[model samples]
Target: MAFAVSILRLAISTAVFPIFLLHFLGLWDWICKKLFPHFMVQFSKSYNKEMAAKKQELFGNLHEFAGSSGKLALMEVGCGTGANFKFYPPGCRITCIDPNPNFEQFLIESIAESRHLQFERFVVASGEDMHQIADNSMDVVVCTLVLCSVQNQEKVIQEVHRVLRPGGAFYFLEHVAAEPSTWNFFWQQVLRPSWFLMFDGCDLTKESWKPLEKANFSKLKLQHLQAPLSWKIVRPHILGYAMK
Candidate 1:
């Protein structure tokens, strides 16, 4: 009976693998490019206020920064629905980078609601490759819940460093790998593959903060905490700033 069950599992795995590949290449991209942004826009509204308060506290000294006579050149990588716009200082000019073009409309709507922030440009490009943004040009770079899904996190960090001016800071909030000994960690690892496939490459168990700590940033201030109880599989989170 056990042998028969093993054979059945093997057959199921073989059957599912091909379809997964096809979907990952085509349908997955479509969903990520289209449906995901709409879902994220609404989802962000539900929890952004709480998250934004935490972000404000973490970014204590920098929260009210209005760069260079109120013309801050801020760039947000993966600025999903512009959830962080309200936290920005008044009269700041923002460059939004997101891989999903569908997010532009949402971003525009959010910008319209913002009192102090203004849109400069929207680039539909991955964090790993943002050559259009020149080196050492931005006053600040913001990334939240982004590093977990990028193709190469180290490369994305490098790009963030390259684009930031000396004394500029990179603000981040990301869900990370849970404590290794915990049951949550086990579930995180077990769910990672399916989670990645369903959620646009988000890896539930990625130790995203390790690369940030190892990077050549001038200073790193970070704190780790568990997210809300509802986010069971990806609850471990890190938030802070890395100065360039």
Candidate 2:
């Protein structure tokens, strides 16, 4: 029995070592960037449908900010593949930002299909520091499923607030921590380390809404719901608009 257990352990180590090495060497980042967008299509479809009405209520009439150009200046931090483009209101000039440059190709393709949105630029920057965007310049700032992976959630929220013009809205949709006593929460804790390794720094146990509630948003409207996703671990979600 002891000999059999030793062999099984060795086998497991042999299978996992190569993946650990790939992650240490940054190849895992490349793999995630290349494949995560495609993997998210079905989830995005269900989420987009569920949140369509809320998005319309938030973005439908932006003419209020349509200064001389008649277009709202919007920035999407961590804009992976521009998945939210189709849901945006008309006449929006969008600036996309992400830490992974590999997503630029996929983002460009998404933009090509979104004829209603005007292309501003894609910047290789992390949400924690968006100095490339001027303070008080954006009419709206949007983020979807991004905060959980950021290095510092509070800093990112502050940067989002800083970049938005006075009265501009910051729209966000994110998966957050499950209830403390739930079985899902227990699994979230158990699976977090491996999940983070495989999914580009996403933390399954992050209570992302904590920082949002603490942020200095002049007006905040947040709602929590279980997203229609096959993965139960990531089903708990929060979506809302915060006014600066």
Candidate 3:
């Protein structure tokens, strides 16, 4: 009787342990969804502001779109919490794309605050598959700090090329693989596995700019930017515009 009872108890514990872990993970994800957006929005404020100025200096052509008689169509992949809304010029319409549906309310609030811009729509779509948007429609495609987490970076760039009208530009800012034999590079590799797991699939050592070079854009330009020491591990970044 004692031996039978011990065997049964062990079997029950084995079965229940997996079930408990599964539920615990699901609950943790739920909590993260509810809280992570606010943290992302807050942490991005200063970085976004500084980058906007530098971006304008690098590609001042965007200013030409301002105050046009007709609205210039723009698509922003991974438009998290609409952090870039304030930086857009007047007489532009924006189409926001993000995989996380939880960001819709935050985006709506951001749109309301942008008096110069018009909100075309928000699609809960990943950058790799922007099928809902019509081809050759967007005048500009903005991708800032986003390529780090995309499942297929090349596919996303191809979609950007496809949706852009002739003379359109794809503007991107992304953290890239650090220089070899450096402390930052070493730390990036060491922390990548765990970091990717914690931070929505963001890989530390992805050479995000390589695919942009392969794409047959009419003009392609890239400039390297130094990240703050506080973010040293993922500090090296590339920013540029690719004209279609």
TM-score, per-candidate, Cα-based? 0.87, 0.85, 0.84
Candidate ranking under lDDT, highest first, comes to 2, 1, 3
lDDT of each candidate versus the true structure: 0.82, 0.83, 0.79
Lowest summed lDDT window (length 10), candidate 3? 59-68
lDDT accuracy of residue 91 in candidate 1: 70
| Model 1 pairs in collision | none
Q: Residues 1-244, candidate 1, lDDT per residue (tens digit)?
A: 4454456545654556754675757766675567788778777876675566686776565544445665778899999899888877777789999998888898888988996777899999999999999999988899988999998999999999999988889999898999987877766655565567667788888899899999999899889997663567766899988989
Model 2, 1-244: lDDT tens digits are 4454456545654566766688889798788877777766555677678767766665565556554566889999999878789888777899999998877878888899999889999999999989999999998898988999998999999999999989888888889999987878867776666677667789988898999899999999898988766678988988888988
Tell me the lDDT of candidate 1: 0.82
